[model samples]
Target: MTAPATKPQAAPAALALADDALVLAQRLGEWAGHAPVLEEDVALANIALDLLGQARVLYTLLGDEDELAYLREERAFRNAQLVEQPNGDFAHTIARQLYFSTYHHLLHTQLATTPAPDAATEDTTAPDIRALAAKAAKETAYHREHAELWTLRLGDGTPESHHRMQRAIDTLWRYTGELFQDLDGLQLDLHTLESNWHTAITDTLTQATLTVPESPRTSAWTAGAGRQGLHTETFGRMLAEMQHLHRSHPGASW
Candidate 1:
């Protein structure tokens, strides 16, 4: 008798989560030398490394981490458009981090606390995924707190700082809806995730004395197809830069 074909649905879901972490890590790493304060240089790098570690674990579960990260084409990436956005300024970076880390922490919390499937029906990778989620939840909590403090600092600082923080919040609002989009193979409640995210964001903005942007989360002009392999023009440039060295030195390693 022939063996049944193994279902590969989980790989795409894992890849999506992994891509989000990896791309955002790369974005944060770009701030290594450019952060406003010397301390921020180290802080941002630590957060980036935490995200990189999560991405590496997820990638290892799927396949070769280097090949998956370096060889994938732009359209092949499954990261949310929010994470791919340019680090416009310190405020922009903080806004992006605040938005994503909040969502990521909630997501990992759900994944970590979810009950494991029965042995009879469990897939081989389930335990590892849950374990990774558990560890990542702790790390992302710090990421979220760091972003929150920065948000408050910038939002209520001098006039220019307040203006930039508000602008960053408004500019990035549209890209956030995609965070709650359905991901295959994950049995999470999207509605709950969206609601919690909204509440958390609203509270933080209020505390910082910034208005929560009224822009629609999803609209004709908003981004939403990243999971379907569609990406923004800027993503293409970023991907090119990220993949350049690996492609240039194929099969060569230090």
Candidate 2:
């Protein structure tokens, strides 16, 4: 008997999660060469590089690395809603970064030992997936520190800054639940992961001497299937800006 012909497979979902880190990282890049303060400007740039590194390694697994970064349509992307939200203000930007990067710290830390079946788990995802994740995990550890320091400073700094920071937490907090929720197969929602994440975030807040605003009921959970090519309006803009070159020229090379 002859073996059946196989069709070419696309990128893995977990690798696509790396895309979430990357796109947000790219958005963070906008702050580069233009942050309010010198220290933050350097910090944002470093964060952007870390994210771009994560994006490059994961995308390299499926095809040409540069093409995936500079190419591909918006609809073709599968990054999460949390990654695409607008930066709003400095406090808002830092708050969102704090929320997501902390999760990145947690998620990537887990991935080193326990990865999605399709990601590094198969042992074919790439040596870089583990390596890059390990590196990103360390960078994220610093991010957690940055966030904690800033959260305390901003949360207690000045009346106005405190108000803005608190409001930032209120505004961005809703989207956070989406992260810990079970996207089931797309993410590794380990046994009791959601509760564990809550405890973790709470513990961080305790040390920061702040609290995660209690939403009336935790904004009705809206699950976005960014992994399935589903996205919010912001993603459309992100796509246009990120892929303008490849879309305009259709595979023209540098």
Candidate 3:
């Protein structure tokens, strides 16, 4: 006899943002004991905690945070491909952080300031999203600054360091396109956000003496499929690792 079939889950905007934060938090947590310096160990841990906090808030909106984070299948995740990419080296990790933190900062800023349609309306979720954005925007500001400082240091430090920084930027450039895609619940004007993100990133790169990496051939017209639950192969392995312990012991808690 066949086992019971799994229920279908809807991919809402909050889930997408939560998955992005959760996946990236796990990636950052991997650097806990392995960071290049003691200061970075503390810094990265704090950033991971910040992302995990954001994920918890977002997950709470949907359902049980534990089950949503651990039990969901690979195809049900809605994070951008950029966050799921493996951290290749120090420069690569910084590059990823630089891109994503910048985007996150801008996105949250807009969400915080954008007024809801009707203040008297019964849609409480709008206020919650806005409130969360206000808090998250401040955290992401520090995250963006941390990445910016490291990018500058590495980009101009040495010939080898400069080369690696450039290479890292080029390698991850393709994944950046997916960050601007529209989501169901967020009524954001993505075009405006993308424009601001480009200016901010380009200015930072120039200050570091790094050229803006060329975008992928079709990136201007086409985006990655991460929002649709289509993720990179590495994401599957990461998901497995993240969920393994939780899956092994059903209902086990600290």
Candidate 1 local lDDT, 50-155, one digit each (tens)? 9999899888887778899999899889999999999998999999999999999999988899787675544555566678999999999999999999999999
What would the per-residue lDDT of candidate 3 be over residues 1-254, giving only the tens digit for each residue?
A: 11114311222677888999999999998888999999999999999999999999877767788989999999999999889999889899999999999999999999888776564442445556667899999999999999999999999889999999999998888888889888665578899999999999999899989999766712554435889888888999999999999999989988
- Write down the lDDT of every candidate, Cα atoms only: 0.87, 0.69, 0.86
Give the C-alpha lDDT of model 2: 0.69
Please name the candidate that would achieve the greatest TM-score relative to the true structure.
1
**Can you tell me which runs of candidate 3 are displaced by over 4 Å?**
1-11, 119-123, 217-224
- RMSD values for the candidates in order, in angstroms, are 3.2, 4.8, 5.1
Per-residue lDDT of 1-254 in model 2, one digit per residue for the tens? 11114311223554466678778987888888778799999998888887887777666565666676666667677676777888778888878877887788877777666644655334344334556667777888887778767877887788888888878877877777656544323336555555666676677666555667788423554445566566777877876787786767876876
Off by over 4 Å in 2: 1-10, 114-123, 126-128, 181-189, 207-209, 216-223, 246-254
After TM-score superposition, what is the CA distance of residue 16 in candidate 3 from its true location, in Å?
0.8
Candidate achieving higher TM-score, 1 or 2: 1
Runs in model 1 with CA error above 4 Å? 1-7, 117-122, 222-224
Worst 10 residues of 2 by lDDT: 1-10
lDDT of 1: 0.87
